[model samples]
Target chain A: MAWNLQSDRPIYAQLVEQLRRMIVTGVYPAGSKLPAVRELAVEAAVNPNTMQRALVRLEEEGLLYAQRTSGRYVTEDNEKIMEAKEAMAAELISGFVSDMMRLGYTREQTIRLLEKKREG
Target chain B: MEEYLISCRDLGKSFPGCRALNGINLELPRGRIIGLLGPNGSGKSTFLKLCNGLLTPDRGELLVCGSRPGVESKKHVSYLPERSYLNDWMTVEQMIGFFKDFYADFEEARAYDMLARLAVDPAKRMKTMSKGTKEKVQLILVMSRRAQLYLLDEPIGGVDPAARDFILSTIITNYNPEGSVVISTHLIADVENILDDVIFINSGNIVLCDSVENIRAKQDKSVDMLFREVFRC
Candidate 1:
């Protein structure tokens, strides 16, 4: 998965986002085993500690699970994966709405634009 | 095992013309990464110094591993100052040798590996390197150890974005997992999420210290936003 350091968000969050994107995009399918922490850290040019943090965060959100000696693996539950995707979508949309409001977009105008964009 | 690795009781410090730190009480447990955040001249550096025994408290007691700072404490603590403390005349190898001499816990091979990753030549003198490069070298040296407590002051403050990433990655990859780290920096947004716990300091007083999850759930705001609201001045 591609990780961008230029984003204004925290690095661990960015790593999480990209890993989630990979799962949704079918790059890392359900029941797949993720890379080792040090290997991923080297790939991302991030610290293994930070990489572990992202992995732990994913584990906390139920997107991934850690096995005793098998390392971190993708969650096998499709329902949970769908729920995580929905939650992420809502959070992203809310963040966008706040940005639009800050940029002086009215609620009515936002609704109209969203409708038009959806139709086209 | 002790519940906390560090415990401070009414810790205070003052400069000739300024009160750097006021009465402060803090408890830091082992295996947790703490982000010590504050604005400029807000006593972040002074607090780190107090814990590292570089600066003595004026009004209270500070404890590390259940004792005051000294030779015994020095063996367990590794620190990286905000400014350059390394002599310019020495090369990277010499610096490694210095650490090996002073700190029995230092791993010279690890230091060389880290430097190699950054393309830092061991034979080059510190004075010959740029500011950012020198800072990276210093960070590599400090992190190449197995100390119990690491106190890093503005570890990423002097570098470019890429260099900052490198420095951060080095920290994550090298430090002992079970040990505690207290990083002092005003750049909260960049490092907020990775922090297991964060202690907000303002004007030498601790305003808040909590886990990232609790802060977000309770305050309904990210740590970065909270920092902006708290330190807007």
Candidate 2:
């Protein structure tokens, strides 16, 4: 899958967020080996160093683990994945709610609009 | 202290009435992609030329891989000039042959592979190809090398958005992990994602040199936006 990154924020941070989403979404399934740093960097069209930094951050967070000579793999902890998914969902919902509020929609009206869109 | 891939101390260059670079001091390490950014006449091209030994600094010392820019340094530096340097009369295949003959690090098979992937007809003469195709051909030749330092000046300046994306991806894929690529261009947003560090220049002087992460974290703005704020005219 192609990575959609914005230039306005820290690329490393964006990389971490995107990679985390991929993990939670099962795009990179748990316990599966991640691509080599250089390979992923090329695939993402980012510098290898930046990609390395992102991978290291994920590893530190227990979302990924690196074995000597074998490369990195996603954590097999389903609970951790669920936790991350919940956090991401919360962030997205909060952002949506804030945007709707700015547009003069109340909480009930915003929920009604979302429910209507979901039904449609 | 370990040696830098490219370093200059109080470097200055002038042409007739204009100073192209002034009191420039920079040290670039290996394994990084650096963006040298500035507007036209801001000395980005001059700094690149100086690195490639195409032009000498008027004053101060400049070194590539620890030695002065010369025949020895040229061996480790692969340069893509702003203009197309390929012979218009020669076919793309012949151009590959020329590069293979000139640079010991040139990989003919890699060059051909890149050409094929880009769907460029190697049998066609340089003069017959479109402007974008010619630029792709040039970029392929430059990236096919195993040089320690790559100096690309205005690589995406004249190309369309699609071609620009292709060129940037090519650079990312073809770069050697042990080497460094210093790309000089004004299109900050397009290349900012791939750059490990950015050096801002204006009026022939270095204004800022910082990691993209630090810039984003501290300034809370994109490099393109910061560039406008810094070099506002």
Residue-level lDDT of model 1, residues B1-233, one tens digit each, is: 55677899899899988889889999998876789998898899999888888888999888887789888788888899878989999998999999999999899988998888788899999999999899999988889888888899999888888877776666555545668888888887666655668999988899998876567657767788888898886
Docking class of 2: medium
- Give DockQ for candidates 1 onward, in order: 0.19, 0.71
How do the predictions measure up, each by TM-score? 0.79, 0.92
- Candidate 2 segments whose C-alpha is farther than 4 A from its true place: A93-120
What interface RMSD, in Å and to 1 decimal, does model 1 have?
5.0
**Clash pairs, model 2 backbone:** none
lDDT (tens digit, per residue) of candidate 2 on B35-131? 9999888999888988888898889998898789898888988999999878899999999999999999999999999888888999999999889
Q: For all the models shown, what interface RMSD does each have? A: 5.0, 1.3
Q: A10-119, model 1: which lDDT tens digit per residue?
A: 55666888888777666878889988887787677654556787889989888889999989899999888888778779998889888889999987888889999999
- How displaced is residue B37 in candidate 2, in Å? 0.5
**CAPRI classification of candidate 1:** incorrect
Find the candidate with the highest lDDT and give its number.
Answer: 2
